[model samples]
Target: MEAFTRLDAKIAPLPLANIDTDQIIPKQFLKGVDRKGLARGLFYDFRFDEQGREVPDFVLNRPEYKGAGVLVAGDNFGCGSSREHAPWALMDFGIRCVISTSFADIFYNNCFQNGLLPVVLKAEEIQQLMDEARGGNHVASIDLAAQTVTSPSGAVFHFDIDPTRKDKMLRGLDAIGETLQAKNDIDLYEMKRALSQPWLEEA
Candidate 1:
């Protein structure tokens, strides 16, 4: 996982509510477990027609948002199945941060684990961000350390995040990375246990 300290990038507007995992990366594209190449599958249905031709009407297909790293979406974003692939797809597509009024429990945590910042702001704040996103090239700066999101016009909004999760993201530590931080302690404990119960180790 990559560190998410601060980001200043153009925002992409995804204003539809209840965007589930299937819509994010349709099941048909779930053939591979690897995270690579999934970006092409992100929002597959919305981005392509039945014949697999690019759909010009999709927000992501628009030229202005082609390289967008921030996404401002509607309420209940990432609802439905608990699929880790959703965040993988988003990250592969260069979305480092997502601002929304609400998000599914699993998806929100998945974002943190995958190095994607899922921000939960008030409805009014989200709407303002959405408006800013609609304005092409209006970039939003997100400071994970400060726990705030700032719009291009100098508007700032504060948000809350668990201190532990914040620290993990700041250090680029995922669950495995966090556990490895105590490697010495773990090794010592295992050594002591082995000495105390040699029979157990043999078993």
Candidate 2:
């Protein structure tokens, strides 16, 4: 996972509540475990029409929102099935942060694990960011270290994040990366166990 220190990029407004995992990537596109190419399937239904043409009105397809790295969304974002692919798809599409008033529990946790920042702010704050995202600039700034999000209009909003999760994201440490941090201790323990029970190692 890539470390998320700060981001100053375009913000795409997705002012819809109760966005489920299926709507995010769709079941048809969940054909592989690999994270690559998942960007093509992110918001597949909303981004493309029945004939597979790009939806002109969609925020992501709009020229101004192209290359957006932050998503200002409505409440109850990422609801429904506990699919890790949702965050993968979002990150693959270049969205590193999602700002909403509320988010599903599973999806919120998944975001941290995948190095995607899920920011929860007051309803009015979210609305403010949403409005700014819709403006011509469509850009925002986020500082993970400072736990702050700055809207395009220069309004700053502070958010709360768990300290452990914050540290992990800053260091780009996923679960495996975190465990590997104690590699020497783990190796020493294994060596001691093997010496104490040689037969166990042979088995």
Candidate 3:
């Protein structure tokens, strides 16, 4: 996973609540396990019509919000069944940060692991950002180091994250990367264990 220290980019306003994983990347696109090529399928149902033409009104489909890196969405974002692909699709689509009042527990955890910042702010704060996002070309500046999100309207909001997850994100550490951080300790433990429990080893 890439390290996400800061982001200053246009915000895509998605004001609908209870957006589940299926709505994010429809099940039809779930065949491939790889993260690549998921961007085309990101919000597939929402972004395309039955004939596969792009929907002009969707926030992501609008020309003004193209290349948006931040998303200001409605409450209970990422609700429904737990699926890691949702965050994968968001990241593949260049969304580095998502600002919402609340998020599903599983999806929120998935974001950190995939290097997507799931920011939890008060409802009023989110509304303020959402409004700013609606205005054309308004950028949202986020600093993970400071845990702050600065909206285009000049309002600042602070957020909290788990210290461990924060550290992992700052260092670009995925599960494997995290384990590598303790390589020395793990090596020593393994060596000691082999000597102390030799009989447990396979012949």
RMSD of each: 1.3, 0.8, 1.6
Q: Candidate 2: which pairs clash? A: none
Question: What's model 2's lDDT at 70?
Answer: 95
Q: What local distance difference test score does each model get?
A: 0.92, 0.93, 0.91
Better of 2 and 3 by TM-score: 2
lDDT of 2 by residue, 86-193 (tens): 999999999999999999999999999999999999999989888888777787899999999999999999999999999999999999999999999999999999
lDDT of 3 by residue, 1-203 (tens): 79989999999889888999999888888898899989999999889999999999999999989999998888899998898999999999999999888999999999998899999999999888888788754788999999999998878999999999998999899898888989999999989989999887756
| Highest-lDDT candidate | 2
lDDT of 3 at 65: 94
Candidate 1 lDDT for residue 190: 96
RMSD of 1: 1.3
Instruction: Give me the overall lDDT of model 2.
Output: 0.93
Q: How far is candidate 2 from the true structure (C-alpha RMSD, Å)?
A: 0.8
Q: Indicate the worst ten consecutive residues by lDDT in candidate 2.
A: 130-139
* TM-score, predicted candidate 2 vs. hidden true structure: 0.98
Instruction: Between candidates 1 and 3, name the one with more favorable TM-score.
Output: 1
Reference-based lDDT, residue 61, model 2: 97
Q: What local lDDT score does residue 43 receive in model 3, on the 0 to 100 scale?
A: 91
